[model samples]
Target chain A: MKWIDAPWIELLRIALEVAATVAFALSGVMMAARKRFDAVGVCVVAFVSAFGGGTLRDLLLDQRPFFWVRHTEFVWGILLLSLAAMLFMRQRHFQPTERAMLLPDAIGLGLFAAVGVDIATAVGMPALIAVMMGVTTGVFGGVLRDVLCNEVPQAFSDHRPYALCAFAGGWADVALRQVEGTVVSPLLACVLITAGLRGLALWRNWELPAWRV
Target chain B: MKWIDAPWIELLRIALEVAATVAFALSGVMMAARKRFDAVGVCVVAFVSAFGGGTLRDLLLDQRPFFWVRHTEFVWGILLLSLAAMLFMRQRHFQPTERAMLLPDAIGLGLFAAVGVDIATAVGMPALIAVMMGVTTGVFGGVLRDVLCNEVPQAFSDHRPYALCAFAGGWADVALRQVEGTVVSPLLACVLITAGLRGLALWRNWELPAWRV
Candidate 1:
């Protein structure tokens, strides 16, 4: 049996997921170039940022050959994109501006959360764990990327509610599934909730509580 | 019920695992200092090197609280070690020559592999997956650490059979159990096989097939 529902709806989720992964992957590649990291370094950041969350989900869920293992295309997709981005960086025309990348970054974050909730639902994870998984999968890639770059992860920073935003959206997603009581398609409900709250978070400039030492 | 035949044996395992984790965590701290990574970077690398395998295993098994979560003391132990190493590095004389660090590094590799295999066996994953988990846990911390340090992991290098040696020892441990039946303690078998093979590999020098392109 196919795990995904409504081919078109699934496609919508995947399209945005791929977009977000590409966007996040590009961010890492750019950072690598700035750091003068070698070819392997560039690939490491790109791969970890793009695949870390899904890899964790698969590992936790015991889903294997792993998503990347089976779908070499996704790996290739990132490689091709990384190459293009690297080339563009060599020229000045297509230089990636960090400011311009935020939209895709937020969209990717929301899309990944939706995917996480959907996967958790299919696997029968409890609601809280599911929400946590969603948020972790959504934000952990960037967190890992930042930590690897020898900087504090924005997710852990108090300046912005990076992980908090993902967590809120994930909680909303799970809550919607429960309150709707099988009336709503869980996938659509998740997608809508994650995307909506993420948008609200960005627009409102949400911040989480933190104290500097 | 207590899982092991004798209390002393179990205590030995716990003691050894703690020592291995501490040693590995210190190695990570040393690497971070050599590169001048920040305090957050030190903590992250220490955590990953010490807990990365168990975390990955628990996540795959969907086990709650994770290993470190169950043994919060483990993190406390590693943290204390990291702090000591960092303070020591400020005034201590150390050179990260691969030649000098090889012995403890190899010992840690084997010990971690044994722990990983033992955990996977308890969780009842496939034997192959369990062996792979042992290897993954043993080497992946260094891989993550090296990547964070902006260097290529020696695992992917033509330099040596780093992961291959761990995989061999882990499989030997598992295979020995199948031959000896349940008479011998599996944990003991695991530790013996891992330490023996890993020690020999490092002492005599071993390498695995690598693709250079």
Candidate 2:
């Protein structure tokens, strides 16, 4: 159950967790706003995008009370953020741009991917399942968000490098875990690999070939 | 865990489970076929619509290994059915219609709603949450299906009595459980209540008032 015994690493994990949550929450808010969802819908979408993946991972691992149920503050945080964003957007006539979401979204994907791998491995899951869980945890929230917004999941249809980046990072994590006396922190390395690849893909307009009938 | 210990009730429950799975799987297949998805996509969508709700409920209840994992036959069955459906549609030039799906979908909704409530109550969850879980299980699959097909959830926007029918049936089950020596079986009563209400709604063209800005 102990992913990190060191105090510094624990603190760092907590910081990264917050960053990931906030980043995803913001992305959710923007998506909801773009769709002109009501305030309640906006909050619901935000909550789903920020927590859906972790919730699924927790359930698969048989964790109790679910994460949002265990930490009600996360729900309240998303609610307030969505409301505030709505008001701010209205006041400034601000039109949310997808570019604004990319950086935070990339960071959150990397952090969550790392966390998912650590949690699955700690639970004694096989390497393949653990890696699948990491990608699922990293990508599922966005899928849920897109679904709620009534869009074909960009992950599936747009042929973007989103899930691919998480998949690569997850394998990198599993590999690092097997290496004895790894020179770098596996979590940090996974995060960098995922975020860096995603950032590079966005900059270079990289795309996976679309599936055809 | 002992939702029904009586031999007859157990047999009925098993039958209902099979019927419900097949019904939802058919609905999923029809939806996917309408979209002209590839065989793999059809199978994935069929599996999601047949199992999505119960999977979420099980996860929230902290049940491990997932229902699908425990019953791999359901997976194989859905896969086979979806493939067969695609072939049949192509050969017959059958345009899958929503009306053709209503009967089985309603029956499956009722059965799954009852099962969801039974499972949640067996876990000692509060009655309200249990009822909520029931409605969620009944309707979430279709929600997932529509989302995957790039449509706003018919449940949310159609203003139909779909989820409300499940809500009412869930309360009926919870209430019947509290009553002593009811003339009818509580499980049977739930199924009748849910299916009857849904059927009536469809027949009468019942609609909920839409929320407007």
Candidate 3:
């Protein structure tokens, strides 16, 4: 908590949040484009992807004035990003692909997980619940994007270790928090471990065990 | 707000809410069964359908201790209902069908819409936003159910006027609130109008114009 009071740390947190939001928004934009959605639909998808996870976490935690609402600039930023993405893709004749979204999606997942865990822990939520919130924050946005696109959530069905990475990262955060006087920021540790694990999973093509039923 | 303070009104409201929740949960149970989901999946879907819309509304309004959390009985009730449903369906050799879900879904929509509007208005939200909350509460649970089942939400993709019924009902509630010394309960009016409209739509096979693009 004291670490968060440092101006530089607060700035870093905001910067990471913005980066994660943009990454998630881009993934939504790509999904919408692939689905042949119109302009408004594309923007809606982007907004949902950017805000859905944190919104859900806030709701569960009973927080007021949602993160996006408190920071209206996020709304404007996503809008401009969505518009730019559409125009840029059209001009370049870019074919949006799932593979193109992987990196950004992974990065967003890690950052969001870190933020979600931090917020939940700040509110005195138990470690298990905090970890779940982290996983929810990291994975729910993409799940929503896929759902809106009328597909089973890739996080649930793709057999890729998406949420599991967030789960591990959340635990890493809890472990770090328990250690006294560690210079390593728990948030940074979470993001690195999560994104790195996800990267390796993709590189090695790891898969979770699918339900047999 | 004074009207809501009446003990009888409070009792009636709780009764309607319980009915609505069960109806929504039943619809979810049927859908999950149709999809051949396991017991855990069926219960999850039922819980989501029963609480998803209200949860979203609570989040939007920044309400604490979500409806389901505040009323632990609702959670237990849904758990029992889900188990009972699976057993009964199996014993009866009953095939779960979309048609079987219509009546319960419509009733749930009407009741949830009324409750959502009441809650929003109680919080001093503007009429338009309150009405939107009503529509959201009526429609979002089913949307989430469909999404979890990996289909486009029928509320959006189906040609039927589902949310439109809630929209009209919301406006009716708004209009009634403006009337001086009305004997009729606005909640009852909203429910009757919404459910009646939905029933008519189903009977007449009414369709909304599809997007051509």
Candidate 4:
């Protein structure tokens, strides 16, 4: 908690947040392009993907002036990014592949998970609920994107350890916070662990057992 | 504004709210059953469809202690209703047709739209935003239901006048609110007009023009 107020930590958190937002927005752009959605649809999807999870977290936590509303730049950034991505992909005849999305998506998941857990813990949420919030913040944007695109959420149905990585990272954050006065930032540790696990899972081709009827 | 504090009006509003929640929950159950989702999926879908729209409205408006959270009974009621619906439908071999869903869904839409508009207006939102809130409250739950079922939202893609009906009803509520000291409740009027228009659309087989590339 003491380390949380450090100037460099705050800067690092903001940078990670921006990177995560861009990553999520890029995933949305790729999905929309693959679906051949119109320009308006593409922008809407990208905005939702970039902001939906944080918005949901804020709502559940009863926070005001949603992150996007508070930071108008996020809205403008997504709009411009969507337009640029659409044009660039179309002009180059670039195929948006799942393989291309893997790295950024994993990075976003970890960063969002760490931020979510911190916020929920700050608000005095129970440990389990905080972890759940972390998973929600990390995974829900993609869920919303898939839902808008008329498909089952890849997080739930892809049979991979996605949200689980966030869950573990949240616990690590919680555990690290318990150590009195350690200089090691829980936020950084959580992000690295979550993203590392996801990257490893992908590289190893790990799979979770799919539900059978 | 004067009539809002009236005891009978409050009672009527509560009754309509309950009816709308039940109707929305029913629609979710039918959809989940149609999709052959398991018991947990059925309950989850029903809960989402019943609560999603109002939750979204509250989030957008920065309302705290969401309506369902304020009333614990709503949560228990949906859980019980889900269980009961599953058993009854299975026992009766009920084939849930789209036709069978129309009446309840329309009633729910109108009621939700009226309530949404009133709440937004009470919160001092401008007329247009209030009307949009009404449409969001009426239509988003069903959108979530369809999204969960892995299909395009009927509100956007069915080419029917679903959200439009809510939009029209919201404006009626807004308009009536402008008239000073009317005994005729705006909530009642909005519900009737919205449901009536939706009913007419179904009977006359009206369709919105499909989007062309």
Model 1 lDDT per residue over B42-120, tens place:
9888888777766666665556887677779888887777877777767667665566556777778888888778777
DockQ of 2: 0.14
Runs with alpha carbons beyond 4 Å of true place in candidate 4: A1-52, A55-111, A121-133, A144-152, A156-213, B1-15, B29-48, B55-96, B125-132, B144-152, B156-184, B196-213
Candidate 4: fnat, from 0 to 1? 0.16
Model 1 chain A: weakest 10-residue lDDT segment is A181-190
TM-score of chain A of each: 0.84, 0.92, 0.95, 0.94
3 or 4, greater by lDDT? 3
Which scores better on lDDT, 2 or 4?
A: 4
DockQ of each: 0.07, 0.14, 0.14, 0.12
lDDT of 3 at B110: 96
Write the residue-wise lDDT of candidate 2 on B121-191 in tens digits.
77788999999998888899898888788977888988879999999999999998888453136677788
Which 10-residue span in candidate 2 chain A carries the lowest summed lDDT? A204-213
Residue-level lDDT tens digits of model 3 in B1-213: 577577877777788889999999999888877776656557667988998898889889988667766566787799899888888888788887778899999999999999989889888899999999999898999888888989668899889999999999998998898894531378888999999999999999999997898
**Model 4 per-residue lDDT at B148:** 83
User: Could you tell me the lDDT of residue A64 within candidate 4?
Assistant: 77
Task: Count residue pairs with overlapping backbones in model 3.
Answer: 0
Clashing pairs in 4: none
Tens-place lDDT per residue, model 1, A93-204, is 5555666666767777777887777678768899988888888778888877776666667677736656666777777778777666542356555556566665676678
